[model samples]
Target: MKKILLITILSLLFFSCENLDDGIKNSNSPNQFSQNFGQSVQRDFMGQVVDENNNPIESAIVKIGSNHVNTDSNGVFILYNVNVFEKFAYVSVEKMGYLLGSRSLVPTNGINKIKIMLIEKAPITTVNSGQTSEVNLPNGSKINFDGAFEDENGNSYSGSVSVFAYHLETSNSNISELMPGMLFAEAQDGSAKVLQTFGMLNVELAGASGEKLQIAEGHTAEISMKIDNTQLATASSTIPLWHFDEENGYWKEEGEATRQGDYYIGNVSHFSWWNVDAYQSMTTLNVTVVDGENNPIPNLGVTLTDQSGFISSTLTTNQNGNVSGLIPTNNSLTLEISGAFNYQEQIGSFNSNSSITIVISSASVNTFNFSGNVLDCDNNDFSNGYAVIAINNYVDYAPLVNGTFTSSYATYQDTFNYSVYGVNFGNNEFSTIVTGQADINVSNTVSINDLVVCLNSNTINLAGDFNLVVTRDDGNIYTFPNEIIQLVSPNNYKTTTTGSWAAGTIAQDQGYNFSINNLNGIIVPNQGLCQGYYSNNIYGENYNGTSSNGLIINNNEFYIQYTITFNTGPRIYTCHYIRN
Candidate 1:
């Protein structure tokens, strides 16, 4: 971890005293549709924070990458044109008196909406380090401390250790909205893996002065959770214990838990979001979101329901209007998308990499199309940018290509009271917003001007499908109908973090996504910044198999491809990827 992350008492106090509506707010608005390839692709996310009782939790600090926004009074926050990499996006939220919460999703090209539920962080009781104590949660989960405690510095500490604990039931319908991240786990071997949860626990300790504490060097804490009856039917005698890495958003396998009767008992030497989950074989699913007429839809909510009834957090479509993520192989799953109408379909037992299209009808909703141009501060065509039209608290983000942009929106607003904003990724610059009122289903021309598209060198966001063609030594060719990839760029002036590909999986192997390090821009002379990588011999699969060297982008009028050559023991394969 390059940065030190902390949840400070000072921040809690500051938030408790600050106004709730001081920052970002959101309202449900129709998604704006636009096709943006390579550098011009944009990703947006909107979601709400709530409590166990389904009440909105407002003013929470929500963050994705360097962009952070406070939830509005309605517990809604929308981040337009956010920075997200790989196939997944990690979002963390914090409030004054709640357990830190986070949700991870595979963001689509345009609008990705999700929901998060935060548990309250109140110490049930204080235990003295000099005496052993055991506490049981209301849900039959139990925790035991053996009279040993230490500060984070490893020194013997200790008067009273305040313990904050919660048991996460796998059977809860809303568990998807409350879980930290997807079932992905970072195994001890550093391989990418997925998980099926038996149960989970959130444990945290605070010193006498509210500072963080941990278990003593030679001590361990025991946790026992009652496995849900449904999960118990298929639960094994032993399960691997994993802890959440909040900073990286992947579960880290550590210890193991043994089943005893109806409970799973585990011991941990440290505290974090610990879980009892077993690795599951997974394949990738490329989801296309569209209306009944086949018009690509954006910001539509799609929820996954597993065979065991374990529902997944809802994900939204991006500007390119699609969703992509991992799904358990040979497992029955159902996708449910809600609008004026509810569309539910079961993707029968899926065993390999594939794609699914969900057609949601919006025939009764008011749909409108708007066209405009995104210009520089001097009112010239601004390429590599996005135009925004916000009404009430809802926003529409349209890609600006060579200064021109077009979008379609579905809104129920009586009259359009909208505002426009733009950004040029070529450089870290923003435009002055244009505000006005318009009629529904009426043609409107919008010009979002006065922004600097500076002549600078930097990385750019990558989205859409990359056509993959692989030819093995045996002359056997494997073709992936489409290879969807995401690379969130580093906004030159705002962040120092270099961009990298987020993990994802495909058909062949267990899980195919790799953690390719340091994605720096490779600027081709006379050509725009399209793709990049700074290291070689990365592990796992970039397209199909492992790459012995880092990727180099080849851009042309027809298609942009990355020719990767690598090996697996005695087998060598050459893979060429073009924008599909």
Candidate 2:
């Protein structure tokens, strides 16, 4: 029994050990096996599929090794999971309408990217046989024989071919004559040779109208041509070659015919057309008129007269105050404008189509009348043999005046009368006068009240100096400085170191100041006599070749005060001195 029990225990132990070994082996067995190592091996491919016309082909099949993909909407495809075991893989792409395309690709351990381009097969619609129909040519163009022909399928055919052209000599009849034949060879070789028969028919029609086909005034013409075995014929419908006058306008018809149908057909009339006649003519002569103030004159009437006579037309000024008149012929013309507001008559002339500008100035109405008596420094009347009143500053007024005024010595008082005529004020100068006498030293004071009188009046004052000679009891002549001297306004005196009359120098021996009063010609001394002479001794009696029996005074050293009044509206007073 003991031996049996030991055997049973050993058997049990052995079985237990066997079971443990089996469990261990079972646990070690692989659950799933990896076909490709640890790397995620994938194959990538892209390609474009296009037709003969360069149009994208969709749904194209792309294969790389055992992998395959379809083209996308843009004719592009991608293939993945290409077997890495293939050192050189065969890649092929195909579509229903495209030719088969293939490429060789080398597989790597990683991703393999490749590009495949597929071209579509030419369409069956392409001409496979050499056959075509003829085409008509335009009326006025010349055709070139050597040209290319292509079909819709992109098939090309090249060979020598011939074409015929027909021209109708007259529209009145339907008869036509065959022109010289044109021959050409296709640039490419293929089934496209059939398209050559339907190509353009080049015809050159030349006659009176160079290279243009013409029909009679009233007729129709039939044109027929042939290419290889094809024939094409057309007839021009009846049309009027010349325009006819109608009540409304001129009428005619123009149209074009083709194998499909007639096109660009319509009836044309003069109302839809226009005739141009161009010409040139002399229009007018532009003229500008200005007043004395150089301002444009508005509404001024301008008369035009030619050598023959006055053109009965008159032109008025525009907004810019310019006048222009149109004349038929180019000739010399005269223009005139009436005077206004004390203005003188103005006349001007110019040739036709020429421009003229006229300036009109105001005329002088009357001569200036200056009547006054010579007075002394004490406001006493000057008694002299002859008191001569001379104007030194106003040289322009000298021509307008008669003999100047002179004081009479027998009267013991001098009454001066002076008239300045036809004096145009402001153009030349303002008026100034100097008075002197022999023997008795007489200083005169002259006042010009109307320096400028229009809307506003200005007053001017002027003074003159003179020396007197007296006979003493011993009958000897004695010369002395005049007691009555002209006094100038302080504002008119200018002090300069280098001037003719320097500062502190004696401007004149006698000085008297005068002013305008009551618009009357009256002489009175406003200031006492000045006791200075000119530094340069200017305008002395010796230089002027004057009789020195009386007191000699420098006229250029006197001072003159004047005022100016503008018509439009400003009033100004100016004071200035005359230097020797």
What shift in Å separates residue 82 of candidate 2 from its native position after superposition?
2.0
Per-residue lDDT of model 1, residues 279-383, tens digit only: 665566667876667767655556676776555545555444565655666768778875433678988577876777776664543445566666554657886
Mark the regions of model 1 whose C-alpha exceeds 4 Å error after superposition: 1-94, 103-117, 171-177, 306-311, 318-321, 360-580
Report the lDDT tens digits of candidate 2 across residue range 384-502.
Answer: 21122233221111111121331111111233333221111221112233333322233333332222212122223122212333332234443333222222221121111111222
What is the lDDT, from 0 to 100, of the residue 438 in candidate 1? 66
Q: Which ten residues in a row have the lowest lDDT in candidate 2?
A: 1-10
TM-score of 1: 0.54
**Cα RMSD for candidates in order:** 24.6, 54.1
Q: Candidate 2's error at 269, in angstroms?
A: 74
- Cα error, candidate 2, residue 363 (Å): 87
lDDT of each: 0.58, 0.28
Candidate 1 residue 199 Cα shift, in angstroms, is 3.1
Per-model tally of clashing residue pairs: 8, 25
Best by TM-score: 1
